[model samples]
Target: MDIKKHKIINRYYHKNCISCKSWLPATEESFYSVKKNKDGLHSYCKACVLKKAKESMLKNYDKQLERMRERNLLPGMKKAKKKYNSSLKKKKTQQIWQEKNKLKLKNYRLQRDAHKKHNITDVQWQKCKDYFNNKCAYCGLKIEDHKILFKGTYIQ
Candidate 1:
């Protein structure tokens, strides 16, 4: 708004904005800058120029979308959705960090499952169960005898 602050970035006598063309004489007070163009001069108020730029940018939405598609992504397919369906997504995504150890989820469960099929006699299981569950020394949860190392009696 100060009359003296309006110095042209480029030495082109910036008058008023072309859109509004607010004839801001060099001596008048204004905040808008005078942008020089190849055509000679660009008229239009600074406010209009900014508004036009925003509109121009908004119009490029489809162009931006196309650019994204050109870079490995298929048209209309969102990268977020693609990641969500991928195996890597589960581990690599922010939703749930994949274990640094990797595809080793449930390894212990699988081992225990296999062991259940091949080892442990009923009596041995009872003994083990009885031993493991003498009750948490402090919590006092009755330990129901569960299977120990599976392996029916063989060579002693």
Candidate 2:
């Protein structure tokens, strides 16, 4: 008796959508899963499925609204809408306030940062400057001379 061996070839599975007739890989990335199908994937690709769903929703828009009304969800939806509008108004008011006080806010932030970095109050810094007669302690340079050299209005 003589025996013969057959070679096996590797092939990737692909399927075509019944509606669009476009070939796509038979995987979740390209197709939706259908448990009843032999390939375990939907007949239509993801894009076709989404398009069909959107069309169906638009076609049944009135029916969907009626269903939502029946379920007593309109009141909750209205409350959510009111809350969203109120939040938007609050944000707009805050933006207006910030725009009106830009210089004041900038000065407050500078003072806060200076206090944090130097651990000194504005009053203490003023008293120290007065003690030195607003001049450099080591070089005895006047505050105006130092300001010209450093290009700063005040020294820390």
Best by lDDT: 2
Note the Cα lDDT for every prediction shown: 0.48, 0.68
lDDT of 1 by residue, 64-87 (tens): 446655564443457655755685
lDDT at 27 for candidate 2? 70
Candidate 2 residue spans exceeding 4 A from truth: 1-10, 72-156
**Ten contiguous residues minimizing lDDT sum, candidate 1:** 145-154
What does candidate 2 score on TM?
Answer: 0.40
State in Å the error of residue 94, model 2: 40
In candidate 2, list every pair of residues with a backbone clash: none
Show where candidate 1 strays beyond 4 Å: 1-14, 25-41, 68-156
TM per model? Answer: 0.26, 0.40
